[model samples]
Each structure stands twice: as structure tokens, then as C-alpha cells.
Target: MVVGELGSGRAGSTESPPPDSAAAVLAGLDEQQRTAAAAVTGPVCILAGAGTGKTRTITHRIAYGVHTGVYTPEQVLAVTFTARAAGELRGRLSALGVGGVQARTFHAAAMRQLRYFAPRVLGGPMPELVENKLRVVAGAATRNRLTTDRASLRDLASEIEWAKTTLATPEDYPARAKAAARETPFEPAAVAAVYASYEQAKSRDGSLDFEDLLLVTAYALEEHRDVAREVRGQYRHFVVDEYQDVNPLQQRLLDAWLGGRAELCVVGDPNQTIYSFTGADPDHLLGFADRYPDAEVVKLERDYRSTPEVVGLANRIIGMAPRRRGLPGLRLLGQRAGGPEPRFLEHPDEPTEAAAVAAACRALVDGGLPAAEIAVLFRINAQSQVYESALADAGVPYVLKGGERFFERPEVREAVLLLRGAAAGRDDGALVPTVRDVLASVGWVEHRPPPGGAARDRWQSLSALVDLAVDLVAEQPTLDLAGFVTHLAERANAQHAPTVQGVTLASMHAAKGLEWDAVFVVGLVDGVLPIAQSLNRPDAVEEERRLLYVAVTRAREQLTLSWSLSRQPGGRRSRPRSRFLTGIAPESTAARRTPAARAAVVLDGAAGQLFEALRSWRTEAATAASVPAYVVLGDATLQAIAETRPRTLTELAALPGIGARKLAAYGEDVLATVAADT
Candidate 1:
């Protein structure tokens, strides 16, 4: 018999006494948390707010269930969104001494189920997982005589993924796309045809994409009773984290996994449901009580992550979103000490906004906050360029968290692999020659691509690789190619990249589940935050509001919500601050002009002079080298050099941005410039 099938009675009275191990797990939990932890027998819905210890509550609940003999560690299946989150859950459970709890992402859990059930049900192994569905879709479009460009191809790919994940087949795509009022750049019929062709091709190749992992598993469970029974037998208790973000297909998988048993618990905040674009339905989370009438609803409203001031701002912003049943507005009572009211800064243009944000970061760091404890978040990835330049100039080290890691880029990976092969047999004397050979083998052309295209970007990345080799050789004159390869491998395996030790720069979506001592939500203009693409749809706009809410709540202490009046200097103040900030009072906070807003662009004495000199050298070096200035020497590195006034070549090379290749190429010029100025 399923554990929760004993009828939806009140928690604990009918249950067995929990073991001694559960006492340690339940020690620090608040009344609400303790109650939720104890309600291990029935369906529980935790409306956990930001930083209210949702992870803590859920992990404890799982541990409590195991200790109380309600469920074994092997019988509990906990699913979250990301691999990082899943790993964290497993780690927490391990720390609590309850190991073997099957904590995984929805896709991971489904994939495991599919692998186990496929051979028995389908009489064959599961199809190979497709790594690049977009490429396959592009090919399919060509075969179907559907003319498409890169952007349209991407849209078509997304539509296909959305269709499949929503349980719609290719035949149903055109109708579904039209009915949903999806903003597809291509005709619905044309996209549907392309999707059809893409599906056929995937079948022909005997492979499945990421979306197929969940769709196929759900299908198997519904169609095959034995498969479903076997899965249910193995894992009986289910706990889902971030249930608000569950797309329809995942919900189907969850249902299939439960197999009519009500032994499940889900935790989410409706206000944090921001992935509607990917077909994630907040309705599932909102309608949990109705679905499982006996489900106990627990609201966790104590804000532990942010100060009272920051929490107040979050509560106010979320209140602006229209309310509905099951999705009530939660007013977080901040438990942390009071902090300064979140700042609302209005700038004349993007450059000034970026500079001010950089300056703010610098001030925070200089005032004793670690650089790693600060972040600059924006609505979109494109908005990071200006801030990246500004931060580089300010001598700040920062990591762009959401983008492709430096070593993970396709070109970089290929080059590294080639280098690894060459290093295996080569001696130190042949290292430079081996590096040159590896670049050539990997199609590295010496000449630059005509500016502003993917080709140019690839060329720059390849060029950077060459610079990397040169730097490595210089740093360790005796270190062979094998040693360098080992270093690269070690860096890749580490969770945080070597370069991620500085201030974090990330898009709002990527900044979720992460908190900082200070955060700057920049590019908050009308067209950017709600974003122009989302303007036509109300639901999309609401998701954007939630995105902003996510950004605001990421701050633990200081918060600055900023926007630029114009895109360029002396341009008209066409854009206004985001609509979400409309009812928010600007009285308590003040805007200040940064150096970028000044008419004269003053810098402090020697540092200012050094900055100018470094910029001049950078411009010349970049042009001659046919690469972006940032590639030659990031603004942050120059800023550090100017402020620190490193006296020797070694000192200059030791700065954060100056890698081995950089030190080899520009080390002499940088040291001379600094020495001459001093």
C-alpha cells in the first residue's frame, strides 16, 4: 500500500513516532518548518518565500520521513530544476546522515526511468540523446524547402521544444501554436512543417533530444502498466522543488511516477514562477490543493536572505502583480537587521549607468565587502558589454556567470584537445611549435574576419588561445605541454572557474538561487526589463515582473535598481524607468552622477593619467593585433594597474586580467607605461 493512501487525515496522530536521528534534523526549524517536517505522511504544499530556508525545510522533511519509518531513503524521490540544486539536495541529505535519497532534476529522474524501462517495454535500448537539435532542425528546414535564417531557425527550434514538452505532436503543432498565440517569427504552418521534418530526422537518427526524455518517459508510464508499477515500487515518496516552474511534460512525468498514489510534497512560490516562455505553467503549483484535496498548505514568509528594507521592496514589487486564487500575495517579514533602503538611480545613458554601477561595486569592495560577494544583474545578456567594459576599467575582477565558460567554448575545447594530444609526446622545446601546429590543425586562420559576425568572434577566441599558450610557456619556462594540459583539465573540473573569483555579472534568470551582499539590477529601462518581445503578451509581461522580483530579492544587504534615459550620449531621453517601478517611491533614495556622466571625465591624479595611457596602448595594440580592446587587456585590468601602480614587469603581470598570453604580448609596454608615469 502507498504511504499516503491511508486517507488525508491530520498529520502525526496516526503516524509512528520519529526516531532519534530526526531530532537533530528538526532542531533549528521554526514552528511552521517543524510542522511541515512532521507532515511527512500526507501531500504537503510549501509556499516557501525567498531565503526562508526552503532547502532546509525540504531536506529536513525528507530526513524526518526516513527516520520516522514513513519512507526508506531508497523510496524517496526528490526532484529540483538544476543539476546544481539536485547535487545540493543530495549533499544536504548526506550531511543529515540519511544517504541514498534519489534527489535529481525532472529530466534526470525521467531519463533514469526511461533507461530502466525502455528495454523491457520497447525491446531495445533508448535512442541516443541529441546534443544539437537546432542544427538538426536547420537541416530539416532546408529539406522541407522552408527558407530560414539563424534567428528564425532558433525560433522554430524553440517552438518545437515547446510543442513536444506540452504533449503536442508535430501534427498538432500548427493548431497549438495558433491557439496559444505564440510569437513565432515564422508562419505557424511553416514552423509546424519544419518541426515535423525535424521529428522525422530525429527518429531516423535514432536519437532523442532533452525534451523527449520527459515526453517518452511519461508515455511509457501511461502506456505500460508494468513499467509504471516497477517505477512506483522503487520510489514511493516524491518531493518537488521549484514546482512553480514545472512545465506540463514534467507535471505529467510527476503524475506517472506517483501512479495515482497521493504520496507527494511540492514546494514553490507562485511569485517566482518566471519561465512561462518555456511553457512552464504556474497553474500546476497554484492548483495543488485542488488536485490533492488533502494536501496541507504551509506558508513560509520569514525572509532570512535580505534585510528588512530589501524585503519591503520585494513585497511591494510583487504586490503590483495581479492576484488570483491559490496565488496570494505574501508579505515577507524580514528577520535580518535593517539595511539602507534599496537605491533607485536614473542615468542619462547606458555608459553613465554602467560606470556608476562599477563605481558602486568598487565602493562596496573598498568598504570591506569581498568582490565575490557583489553582482551586477541585467535583464538580457547583451546589456553586459557596457558593464563589463566599465568594471574592467575600474580594475575589478568579475565573472560572467551565465555565458559559456572560457574553456568550454567549442573552439577553445577543440584547441585544448589538440594541445592535449600534442603535449602527450612532445618535450618542452617543442611546446610552442606544438601549439602552433594544434591551432593550424583546428582551422585557426591568422587573419581577422570582417568585423561584427560570428566568424569574427570565433577568430578572436582562437587568437586568445594562441595568447594563452604563449602565456603558459612564459609562466613556467620548464613546464611541458602535458603539465599545461593537466592544469587546464583541473580548472575545468572545478565547480567555479579560475576566473570566477571576482564580482559576478549575470542575466536575471541566471542570478536565481544566488544571493549577494550587494546587487545592481541595471538596464531597467522600459524596453529592456519587461523587454520589447514580451510587450505584446500579458502573461509574458507578468513573467518579466517576476524576473524583476527575482533580481531584487537576490540582494542580502544593498540593492540598486537603475536605468538609463537614452542608449547613447546626448541622445533623447526616450526610454523611461521600468513600469514595475512605477508605484515605488523614489523619495527615500537618491541618484548620483558618475564619472561617465561628467563633461570633463576627471580621474584621480596619477591613476587617471595611467588609465589614459593604458587605454591608448590598448587601442593601438587591439587594432594592430586585430582583436577587441577587452581581449588585449580588459578595462578592469587597466584600472587595477593604474590604482595599484605596480612598479615591476612581474607586478604588472601578476594582476588578475594579465594571463600568461597577455603578459607575454603586452607585459613590456604595460610595465614601461606604468614606470614612465611613476
Candidate 2:
């Protein structure tokens, strides 16, 4: 994954794949990458393209400095999306033998410094992490004889957390609580009480949720001169990963930590800025240069990840995004040469689409691609079920991101509650067993039943929870409480967890930092992809386009773009292809014929000769199977395969279009067709 001129196994050694040339050192980089990485003086802004290697560039820039001795790794601060990403970057640095670098998630970094000065700033001990804040809140309500639905409690907690991190105090909660009251469960006063209770609990326990770290640290540094001075002195250079995902809390923390002295290197793909609802603002990244006037800007205009065709499709889609405020322009550099045209697969319904996607994945993997090298991207987390069923049927290995797996399942959570409670010696996990027994025996708790009294509502709600637990316990008597929680955590931590298929089923949002040989973007229709709500706002529409851009670019070599025109299971057909697709011309020959047709043809055939070549090329594989290549393999996959000319199963597997089923079903036939000329 680390790319550079190499000597033997070492990266950045004298033998590194000589930087294509001095002129080509930054060739594979996007305009933003080069600009952000090279700027050593002040703040630099890099609005990256999806899969354009923003993370790679930031890490390497630090490596570049260390290699060039421009700055010690310790002097720089690297911030990323999650704790996992930060660890990955740190490992990458260690792999390159780069030492003294400080790479941590924004929250992690903020907390580290916060804890270092917590005693002085907050006048107390460091905060504890809220590993399961929702569970704690739910348990608290249960114990108080005022049981509430877990969902309601979680929603309330999340809202309170959001407000707090945005620097909203309990006093400020009334207005926000009022505006959100329509959607939230609790009234303003109730919310304020809960917020107070939640903070009290956290402070009493010396624990903090993710957001609290940023909010607390930002306030601490801004208020405490010694802390600010120490931080500014410790790290003079700052490199931020996924800069677009930096919420206001994070931005505040960054500012206070910088103290107007640090040289900033921030990199992110605005197109991948899907966390806006979570308070992240790409505006901070896009406006970096203006924020720091003397900053130099460079553009890494070439991409090394996605094939040109895929890149072209992604670029066109993102071009629809309204320009960011205060930025000159958005430049996407798709450096990879000719490959596949992104296909638009149409399915009859969700189930059918899931089946086809699963089949497609099977074809890719059976052909020789690694399971980890393929992903099925969808709009919503719930949409993954169909794909999961289809994949399970195909006996293909797959991993689900964002869904509660076996361990995180309700049953698993119950098990964990028992185990963790026991481990903490809650009277030999008595509370855990009691909670489980309560849910199992009564189904659910309705301590504060509806106004209809404990009749119809109370019994039903409690019964449901009890039934669930009873069923789980009935199925597995040997499942002790503590053992169950450990199992869930382990299951969640399984990075290479053996999936039913090698494919990854993730929401478009979760697929951000990943890349694969082949990618299938499903459920791309109007109400589904752009989602009906996003159709009105220019910014929302752009965000949708950016989401599409992210999905398309995740494909390293081959990509399949699909949409279902209808949602079945008795529902009337209502959805349409995304209007975003209206801008894209179809590739049918009939659509490509006249003089006036050329513009349409060029637009439809984003890559002219290459597009025609794919459509025209011989395909003995699918021909023998009597199915159109577009069915078994999308046009994008075919184009990439044709252009790349992957000679063997291994190489073909490396292409994104061919999945396990396709490879096993048509590998030889396709290769035979390719071998005819050679």
C-alpha cells in the first residue's frame, strides 16, 4: 500500500521505484494532494477527489519531511477520521521506519492533550470513555423505575451530545430542544434534565464520550495559557486526514491547539464530505488558503487509484456539485489510463438487485479476486439485508459494515451486558442477569407506560422485550452473560472476519477509506440514491453527487453502477433513475447514430474509442452462456478488462468487473477470447 521508489523491501530507500522522474514525483497525485503536501509555510487546503489518496499524501508528506529532514516527525500532528485510521497511519509510518510522528484521530489527539492538562483546566481527573453510553442511559432509566425505549434514550443522548460538543450548555439546550422537540422524544425540560444527568454521570465516572473530548480540549486550550503554550510548542506542523469531516468542535480544538502558530496541512475530498449532519464542515478545508494568506497551493492533478473511465464518471457526477465557498475551482485528477465505462445496471426490484450483486460478487471472487477487494455499496444501512441474503445463498464470503453483526445483535448485547457487568463485579453480574431476566420474562419494561394506563401498551411493550430474551436464552442455555459480551466485542473487532462471501456490504459512507479491485454500487434510483429529501437543496444534491462520486472511485480497476426502477414486496413502482443520470447519455447504438448524435455520443460515451471498443469487442464467455455481457458483467467491467487485457485468472480477478461467479463461469472463455490475438 505504501508506494515509493523502493530498495528490496524498504520504502523510500535509495532504490525506490525512482520517482517516475523528478517531474513525475507528483504525477499520480491529485491537485490538492500536491498542494497540501508541498506547502511548508502556512495553512494549505486540499479538497480531494474520492479515492484520490488524501490520506496517503498526508502520511507521506510527513514521511517526506522526515526523509528530507525538514522536520522531525514528533513536531507534526496528524489527525484522522477514526481511531482505527489513526492507528493505521501510525503503523504505515512505522513500516516506512518513520519515527516520532504523532498521528491520532481528532478526538484522540484532543483527548491526549486534554488529559495531559485536565487537572489544571477542568480541576479534576481525566474523563472516561463512554464505550456504550446508550446502554448506560437505558440501564439508568430502568433502575429508576422509569424505563424508556432504548431508541428514545439513544436519540436523546445523541442530541444532547451534539449540543454539548457544539459548546451548547444546559441553558442553551432550550432553543435547540424546542426546535428538535418535534422529532425527539423528550420535552425541553426533560431533555435538559437528561443532559444534566448524563454529564453528571460522565463527570462522576471520569468518563467522556467522543464529542466531549473535542469540546473539552478546545475549551481548555483556549482558556488555559500554559496548556496552549505547551501544545503549540510541541507541535508546530499539523496534518489532518479527512479534513472535510472535521466538525465545529474539532475545528475549535484545532484552532486552540494551533494558537495561530502551527503550519497546517489539511487534506480531504469534499466529494466525500458526507458527515455534514454530524457537524463536519468542508468549508474549513476549502478556505484554508484564505485563512492563512501566505500559503502556497499546488494541485496533484493525476490519480493513481481509479481507472480513467471510472474517474471520468465520478468527475462528471461531482462536477454537478455547487462550488464550495471561497475556493477557486474543483479539479479532479484521474491519472489511471483507459479502463471501463461505469455501467448503469437496472434491476426489477431490490431482491433481484441484491441477488445479481451477490452473483456478480461470486463471479468476481471465483475468478480469483480477494474477497476483501470487492464491496457492495448502498444508500441506507437497512438495504444491506437483501444483499446479505443473496450473498448467503451464493455461499460467498462477505462482511457487513455499520450493521450489528452476530455479536452486536440484540441477543449479543444482552449477553455482553451480563458479562461486562459480571467482570466489573456487579454482584457477580447480578444486574446483568436481572436485566436479561426482566426482558426475557416480561418481554419489555414499561415503568412509565402510556396514558392508557398499564393495560394495552404496558403489557405489549414489556412482553416484546421478554419474548426476545426468552427466545435467545432458550436457543443457547450455555451462553453466560460475561462470555456473551466478550464474544460480541470480538466479533465486532474481526477486521478479516470470515464473511459468507469475500465481498463487503457497506453503506456508501462506510466505504470511504477503502479501495477494491471491483465495486458494485447498487440502489442508485432517484428516491433511493439522491433520496427524495435531497432533491431540493443544491448543497444536499451536491452531497448526494459526492456520495456517488465516492462509490464510483472506490473501484480500483472495474466498477458497476446499478439502480432498481421499482421497490417490490407489494409496493407500487414509484422510483426513477437519479436525475444525476439524466446528464449522462446512454450508450446504445441507436442513441449514438446521427450528426447531432455525436455530442450525445461523446457525452454518453465519456471515453469515445474506448467505449466503442468495449461494446465492439468479442466476448465468447457470456456469448456461450447466452446472457448479455451487461448482465453478467457491466459495460464498465468489460471496458476495463478489454483495455487492461488481464491475461490470466489472477490478473483478470484484479480487474473490478469480474467477480467470483463470473470468473468460475467464464474465466477460460474470456481468456481464450483474449488469447486469440496474442
Clashes in predicted model 1 = 6
lDDT of predicted model 2: 0.63
- lDDT (Cα, tens digit) per residue for candidate 2, span 1-678: 011100012322332223333234344554456555555555666555565566667666676666655665667778876656776687667655575677677766776777778788878778678999887676544544455786788777776766765566777787864543324566666666677777777777777887887877877778878777777777878887777787777788888877877477777665678866455677787777667776555444466788888878877887777666765555566776788667665544566566556756766666678776898999888888888877766556566776544443454356446446555563343333554454544344433322331242233333333333345467676555554445435445532122322477899988877788899888878877787766766676777887877887789888877665457633444456677777673632422365222211222233344435445443544576687656666654554454445567876765554688879976776676566534
lDDT of 1 by residue, 511-597 (tens): 988999889898887788799978988878888998999999999998878777778877776576789888884531212334332
Give the C-alpha miss distance for residue 469 in model 1, angstroms: 24
Weakest lDDT window of 10 consecutive positions for candidate 2: 1-10
What are the per-model C-alpha RMSD values against the true structure? 11.1, 14.3
Worst 10 residues of 1 by lDDT: 1-10
Cα-lDDT of candidate 1 = 0.77
